[model samples]
Target: MNYFQIWGIGFILTLSLSLSAQQVPDTGYVAHWNHPPYAMGEGPVVGVDGAHNNFHKLNAGFRAFGNVAEAGGFRVVSVDESFTEESLSDLDILVIANPLHASNLGNWQLPCPSAFTAFEIKAVDRWVKNGGRLILIADHMPFGGAAYDLGMNFGIEWENGFASIESGGFGDLFTDHFAPFTNADSINSIRTFTGSAMSSNRADVYPIIILSEGTLNLPTIAWNFDSLNTAKPLAGYYQGCWTRAEKGIVVCLGEAAGLTSQLVGPEEYPVGISTPRVGGNLGFIQDMLISLAPENDDFMEALGWLRYREKTTKVGDIPFRFQVIDWQRQPDGHIMLSGEIIGSAVSFEENEEDYFVVEVGPMESDDPNYDDRFSRWRQVSEFTFSREPIVYPD
Candidate 1:
């Protein structure tokens, strides 16, 4: 097998804001559990399956991310069954770690195997299309191979091999492995320890973590790191990409240890996201999660609160019902609402209005009740008001 490249540069986000100390609520809605054959363990592992046998929370597994998500007001729960509409409906995010459905040979394998069924893949795809978020973490050869099929549904293509750089020197085991995030200062470096690469040409996709130009995705006919004879390096493939679905979001990363915290063997060499010397992997992942779904807290707060349409609503006298999509309190003590407008096709003239004006139409549905209630849902970006909404905490 020969390696290939993913061309083009991505539009990197240049802005960096001070991280907010504002706390979000733990909604107990995160489904971190995996339906086995996948690499995600329920609790902990104590044995090896091929090259990955360790089961401790601090190893290459996703336990560290689970812990972080838990601390950041998310309820991390393990999943063991196949993904379905009803099963995934209530969750905010579903994480699929490196899964290996077949036996893991300790030797370097060229192509890993699939852990997910066809039905499961379709279910996940539909779930994301219907307002569900998915986070996929696939590692080196075998892990990449296992996830290849599932990722294809989202317009992602995995290289199904090991990706590294010539600068790292192919001889060293751990010391020579590292990957860097492009145009991001907060989470600048990745301590890559044998991971794969991925790319997407879909219009809905955007690169988040990009390997540098010199990065190479080397084909592995077998897990033969000792022999580089058949290896052909492909340059500049995307290591991570985020896609915006019809109503949901999908985050895919080529490497796993970038967001992991683990000790390697008895010597206890740190080689994960939690390593003190590691770059912005931890912070970068946290920021990505926050950016993806910060509205969970707002949704929870507004669950039962009701405000009069007159007092709580209207963008320039359009009389639209308020639906909070994004509510954030900036570090400067300013609270902002970038949400949706319901029940109206509203627009505003710039000269006469004090705030930015945007045109949005009504929602469409066959049900009279639903159509009347939510049919006119249009986005309202950066819409600020003098009075606070009912859901705002004092």
Candidate 2:
């Protein structure tokens, strides 16, 4: 018998297997943000997608997600229409969770098609490139298959299989690989229940939850597994990752339960953020949302000197440092950066790519030819710098 036919018989014999583990949003779950970044309803606009026949919606399965985001000061809204330029124009961030195709709604077998159309995928791609953040959460099996096309646009290869610990049991664990993105001194290892796996080789991609060794990817009919099915190791694959898309950022998660609180089974066993094993998930979620938000002007004003190493080794690689000591917002809403370097006045102009570009010469402002000897202008991305000076050995 073929794989599906074999599993189909097993599935029919235990029809209640999948139905018994039904998960619903944990209504009593509460998210606490000690210091909210913005006042209520004053932060970036976040759209939680309810279209595309999603299994998780803002008011239902993903209620804790919206609660956490709102507690962190983001303005959350529901998106009921398909993605289009007009639909995405006003939103600063979009969140999609566990979307399923119409055909795969009740049947989690094969033949899963893309949840999004080619035109919608292109529109979202263009929107992100022009500065729109996206948070995509695709769970196991049909969920991953549904988001395959949209995930591909952002360099993610979704594995549409159930990932579990090869040694047996659910709850795969992971440690943080990239800490700078979250600025956390040390993050506790987080746990994930039966989810999917994904991989990306892009240089810009940063891993948050990397699957460990002994984890196996089982490609089976959902909730039906047997010894006859072949297993593939998913070591080194990512369960959660983030990357920059031109001017915007994209966070792709292989699972959705870990980010939200839910209760499974007839007895209402807690899973996801509600469980004690994943307590660190709330902090991680808050950090990620704060990082993804647009830069705050008050926070930027407190920044110190930004250091940049010269591409050429002409001056023994002594790094150049610039600080925006003062700034003013013009009537047209453009910010002008002005500062002094070694007693010489300097100003920065915004480039077409939104980077700050500036030119400078010798440190001495008394030199008459200083203006004539200006060095080449360079583009610098937004980065926080230390207040202490950088010392290089002679």
Candidate 3:
């Protein structure tokens, strides 16, 4: 790998030396993380807590996802401190953890309930309607892997509240004996969801994780319920997540635990991008972030990005070498702009093609460009081609 392509390096460096050291990942969205416990390391001297078993900012190793620590990169922050109506504008995407509440525990360990205010629900609904991409990861416990809260917001519901993975076992909840699900979601299986609300948010909203079919549902909170009384999950549970809303959109996992990460060997499972060691769960989270914070039409995708699985680009293609102009940072930090594909300037007869000449055009905001033949329209000269792959550059 070239020096820049190294996983953790790029995130800690800045594009122009004149800029402050605080800015990293100069190319894409500077990540804003509110991940509690797992992703929380910054600066040079950060510590690791084995209890949580999360990727330390610096040590998670780019082999899977790039190290988030270098850029002040991915981090853990309090939701209230990191988000506001105004701050919402800064985010390109949002991923709310869908950890299960508690099917096993007799009563929830703490707190009476996890309720949302009317305003909070409205803000989230509004965000997706206006083109925000979202990903939800599941956890089992108080919620029993149903991840019902997030599913509720997205007009979906996961019924498998507490599964006894081993054929038939009650694995007591309320007690510490219950273990968390760590298997990564399967991207291949996830993309099959055909919900319009899911697709409208982004033409490319596909799944990175796939959960088991026919999940069980516990309508209420954690604790053992009458086995005979538990409800079967219904597909239409997501009926009103959105419609007539501005950016009206929603996508949901039938089971939250599908996004859980498992550290098993390649013999047992596979990741989306063909990264044997990394889990699809990691790719699922990274994919959500990339979707939310797209910097240009040429946004990056993870190892096994499913949407572009069939598309191919050669090194010398002009469209791949195309430049982006008119890209402006909106007051809310969202970007708006246009793009064009530049064709080759080769002149076989004259052999004088300093600049490739193709008639490019009919371009406007979000407008598709199609030339009569192999045409090259005018484009801004603010872009540079990659001579080689980019490594880490924080």
Candidate 4:
């Protein structure tokens, strides 16, 4: 346990130092998209969108999804400020879920409803192109209509309707096995409930979850009528899609409920990811988050133990001995790192034998030939590794 604690010590040194000096900056903060005129603040926090229609972080309606993100090492923040380069500069990701303009929320009908203005959309475009991630959740009818314009900028066309199955039972909307976008066998099970459909035609854009063959989108003035009601048909589209641009990534989900956990009434019937009937939503969302924010590393719990031995190394004529330990594999299949400094020369060989090597210490100069200035010992402060386990030696 002590060793594990020490393992994270390097990662938090700067944070600890800042806290000790009380120099916390409000910038570089996580912000959940919220503007009262366009969004609601039913919760105590002004930026929190607690309205039944919105999915702000502080909203009771979105607690399940919020908790899952927090559990995964992300702090859910509320953003009230308008979208601008300076305002959005601090954020790594911006989430807009089931948003509605102030006037539209009164009746919740959509002839024309803009969740975000043209300027705001341009600002978001600039932000994403500068390496910021965006998550847009537009569920059914009005919500989809509201976010449709912004989706178009990313090459997404949202079908403003309710996604359902052609065979048409209540259970038709409940997908037990959603299709995976890639060839990977990581298919997920989920209940979409009532949501919109989307499609994108950009090279960088890819589908993450596909609604089944029988699925269709049903148009409505409002999401009022039952599945049996006469509605316009919108067939063959994606339930979720993501885009990977040169600088950043964008993920869009048609159904917000699939990622959420909530009760319908006082009876407290489970909905979304919380229901036993629908599972693996957490893994699906986590994968999306990882794709959007590749810089955020997953912490692996250490297993087993090893002993270290001293070995001699040549820094020109000077002989230096350092402790080198046998590599131990972590549960995630990467080699566990020891609290020792090993230079670039031995690093590759170690990785070749271990498949993946975790190295912790200060960075060295890029020059192959070491200089006296670069030879000085710098303490291990942080350890960063590839998102996927390394296969080939490099």
Candidate 5:
């Protein structure tokens, strides 16, 4: 699909500090998916943090983030309360984007305190250790400083500064940097606006977006680069990384705009995923979310019920059964449900929503006229099974 057709063709070559203030969510932007992993509202629940004075919320800056997750078949909802055991109990994944301390609200400078309290940090740490995934994003100086404590608890050392390449404040991150996560053949590049950099000494932590030769300028005030600022080379730092936290996982991004689709300035110039340069960002987001989501056991349980029915039922006084001998996932993210009934094999591609019969013949035979032979069983049945008992119609 052509992203330009949806995002339009107004790209901003450079994003200045002045233009950053004018940025807003692109309300028209919609995340398109060729194959959603689950049925609508059937996937894992994702909570977008709205408390702690976050700069990105569901109805505002991170609107595109929620849309992307929803398009990928996850249920997205806003989290309006602080981090706690009870508050995070129901969430499969927690996304905290550019959260800020109340003291730093509208005033980005030195003395940027932690957005999360000691109790909140401990709660989050325990929650992740108990199997709650987290996506922590902090951008630039103040944001990095704000999320420092929460990030540090997970082994990430946030540099509270602006990361800039030789080109400018924004640059394209290539596939080489996404090692152990994605490959060059899968994705070409991802564009990121001016953001911060981070590092982790933990061996378990895998680098996602590593910075090339660049400078990290630590200014006392946000975006105020002067001689007074302490500048350091950002050669080995990371813009994004991920690691496992006991039973759960943590994905830390030093930048926020890369996950967002927003318009900048009066001209409405595109930035982040909306820009033409970052066409692969949507795919990246989908892959990341799939990794964060728990295994799809609901589909497997539903299939188990069918297997049980096959083993117990009979047709016309003759023992009738269809057993799923083998199954595998296709390249398009659909499952190939392969089964045998009365020594004849049938195979079909299925998503969580429904099953589609594609072929039917002998186990190792290839028949061109198989479609004609199994015309009546083109579709097996829609899987409406849940934890409750199945009721049959008389």
Candidate 6:
């Protein structure tokens, strides 16, 4: 991911910012959320509409970034207001709720305009490459607004197909729950959570949420929102899992159809169920929004990187790194991140050399009691020289 001037800032920010008096950083948003009740779903989780999402959740999240963080806080502004070179310079993070295909996320190496435009790819490249945190919410099978445009940065996409749920109420298309790849039966000593009816090619990842049961199957076909290919939606989530690929962390969907759902609005909400709380759509919206709040370390960073739209190879420790890796930006905007690590360095001659080879696919989200380290490097790179991240193609 490249980060030149996301949201139009005028400086480069890093983890080095002071811990006591952080200022607010310029942040941008992409408009994609558009479901009736507007993409709402919740069973056991607790969420409150208009509470934190705008008034409730956001204020708290920002308080930590702005008032709490030493260097700066996250301030959401209009896209036009924030889109600029200088703003990008000072931008600490960018959140793309559900981006669609655009001139951004492009490829210029092709003889003609690539399937994607260079601008389309480069915007994301510059943002992440420059250490900007990105958060992306992707749609699975049914295309939940604009999710894939940002999802691709991490090598993930909604399967764009159908979905099914067994032993649960609602249609077979409505699923009860979903699982991760690592939680399934072991094959050849490695757990392969693919082709289990719900998901395919699942990898171990920090899953945000999975279908519990009674979830709808996505649209009946797969189509690029940008291209409007309408190729036919694929199968959807059904207690499924998938493997993340590429160099960045990924969150994948079962099928385009699985992500399809109805959103709950103020008029649509029902109150007085949980005493002071509302019931039905309103309650459901609140709970789901809370889940979407990203209640862990640096929610902004995690979400930003997940939706990164560039073409670079980046890997890092979950809570450790809050920004994207540095990479060269392509002329047309698309970035090229390829090259094996330089092996056999003169610095560490012993077994610490294998750290350069640390690579992994998507993470599994189904297991409640799973090891985070298991989804990443098989062996942690214990470099005698910790300061060096040997760069290739230098």
What lDDT would each prediction earn against the true structure? 0.49, 0.63, 0.29, 0.49, 0.67, 0.26
Q: List runs of model 1 lying over 4 Å from the truth.
A: 1-60, 105-108, 167-191, 215-223, 226-234, 294-394
Better of 2 and 4 by TM-score: 2
| Model 4 clashing residue pairs (backbone) | none
Per-prediction TM-score, please?
A: 0.57, 0.69, 0.39, 0.58, 0.70, 0.32
Candidate 2 at 3: error in angstroms?
Answer: 31
Which stretches of candidate 3 lie above 4 Å from their native place?
1-76, 81-84, 87-89, 98-106, 109-114, 141-150, 163-228, 231-280, 296-394
Task: Give one digit per residue, the lDDT tens place, for model 6 in 95-136.
Answer: 332233322223211111112234544654564554444443
Error of 6 at 387 (Å): 42
Q: In what order do the candidates fall by TM-score, top score first?
A: 5, 2, 4, 1, 3, 6
lDDT per residue as tens, model 3, 124-223 = 6676677654444333334313344545555444343433211222221110010001111122112111111111242223332222222233434443
Give the least accurate 10-residue stretch of model 5, judged by summed lDDT.
1-10
Scored by lDDT, the top model is 5
- Candidate 6 C-alpha error for residue 72, in Å: 13
lDDT of 1 by residue, 1-394 (tens): 1111211111121111111112222222232321121233321211111222322222235566766665555556666556667666666677776666545545345445666779878888998888677877777666777788888888998877665545323321111111111212234444445466787777546665455434343545434455443344434466677775666677788766556555454555444554455555555555555544524322211211212222356666676544443344545333344333444556444322222222222334677545222123333344443222333332
Position 218, candidate 1: lDDT: 51
After superposition, the stretches of candidate 5 with alpha carbons farther than 4 Å from their true spots are 1-20, 166-175, 182-185, 296-394
Residue 347, candidate 3: alpha-carbon lDDT: 28
Number of the top TM-score candidate: 5
Shift of residue 375 alpha carbon in model 3, Å: 22
lDDT of 2: 0.63
Error of 2 at 73 (Å): 1.7
